[model samples]
Target: MRMNAKDEAEMEYFGSTIRLQNENVTLRDTVQALNAALSARDDELANIEDELSDRENEVTRCERALELRVAQFNQEAEELVQQKEDHRRLKLECKKLQNQNKIE
Candidate 1:
C-alpha cells in the first residue's frame, strides 16, 4: 500500500510537532534547574553577610571594652604616682624635725 501525498504531509507535521514538544520540555527542565541553583546561591550569600555583620558588632564591643580597661589602668597609675610623692614629702619633713631636735 502506498501513502498519498496528503498522508505524507500529515505524517511530517505530526513528527515535527512531537519533536518540538520534547524540546520544549527539555528547555523547561533546564530553566527550572538554573532557577533553583540561583536561589540557593542567593540564600548562601545572605547567610554570609549576616555572619559578617555579627562579627563586626563583636569587634566593636571588644574595642570599647579595651578602651575602658586602658582608661582604668591610666587612672590607677596616676594615683600611684601621687601616693609616692606624698610619701617622699613626709619623709623629708620627719628628717628636718629630728635634726632640729638634736640641735636644740
Candidate 2:
C-alpha cells in the first residue's frame, strides 16, 4: 500500500513540527539552568557587597579614632610648651630681683 501524496506531505510537516518542539524543549531547559546559576551567583555577590560595606564602616570608625587621638596629642603638647615658658619667665624674674639686691 502507498501513501497518498497529500498524506505524505502531511506526515513530513508533522515530523518537522515534532523536531522543532523537541529543540524548543531543550532550549528551555538550558535557559532554566542558566537562570539558576545566575541566581546563585547573585546571592554570592550580595554577600560580598555586604562584607565590603562593613569593612568600609570599620575603616571610617578607625579613621575617626585616629583623628581624635591626634587632636589630643596636639593639645597636650601645647600645654607642655606653655608650662615650660612660664617656668623660664619665673626664673628670670627671681634672678633679676637677686641681682638688684646685690648691687644695693
Per-model C-alpha RMSD: 2.0, 1.9
- What is candidate 1's TM-score against the reference? 0.80
- Per-residue C-alpha lDDT of model 1 across residues 1-104, encoded as one tens digit per residue: 99999999999999999999999999999999999999999999999999999999999999999999999999999999999999999999999999999999
The sequence of per-residue lDDT tens digits that candidate 2 reaches over residues 48-71 is 999999999999999999999999
lDDT (0-100) at residue 60 of candidate 2?
A: 100
What's the lDDT of the predicted structure labeled candidate 2? 0.99
Scored against the true structure, residue 51 in model 2 reaches a CA lDDT of: 100
Cα TM-score of candidate 2: 0.82
Each model's lDDT? 0.99, 0.99
Residue 98, model 1, lDDT: 97
- Candidate 1, residue 39: how far the Cα is off, in Å: 1.0
Candidate closest to the true structure, highest TM-score? 2
Candidate 2 residue runs with Cα over 4 Å from true position: none
Worst 10 residues of 1 by lDDT: 86-95
